[model samples]
Target: MVIKGGILLAIRYNSHRYTRDIDFSTNQMLGDINKDEIANRLNKSMAIMGESL
Candidate 1:
């Protein structure tokens, strides 16, 4: 997780809000990580959450 490496924030808005993109915020340590890492980590998180499904 980026937060593990020092990402300090995160924000996500619903697509139903009429926005074209989800809004995100972070004090992410980009040099230490990148978009793919964030996405993959989030996906893995979702997989864990979805195990209940």
Candidate 2:
């Protein structure tokens, strides 16, 4: 999923309950970041953790 900017994902720091889907929080990226690329990266990262898309 596409993560919008100016949000915070609180689960990273303290241990919090999480949902099945990942919640993202990112500051606005000034440069170019392809959506497909992000999806691919996320998919690869999830694969490493034995998670499926």
| TM-score per candidate, chains pooled | 0.42, 0.49
lDDT of 1 by residue, 5-44 (tens): 1222222332233423344556656687677877898899
Model 1: weakest 10-residue lDDT segment is: 2-11
Q: Evaluate residue 31 in candidate 2 and report its C-alpha lDDT on the 0 to 100 scale.
A: 64
Best by TM-score: 2
Model 1, C-alpha of 5: deviation from truth (Å)? 23
**Which pairs, if any, clash in model 2?**
none
TM-score of 1: 0.42
Residue 7 in model 1: lDDT: 23
Per-prediction count of colliding residue pairs? 0, 0
Query: Ten consecutive residues with minimal summed lDDT in candidate 2?
Result: 4-13
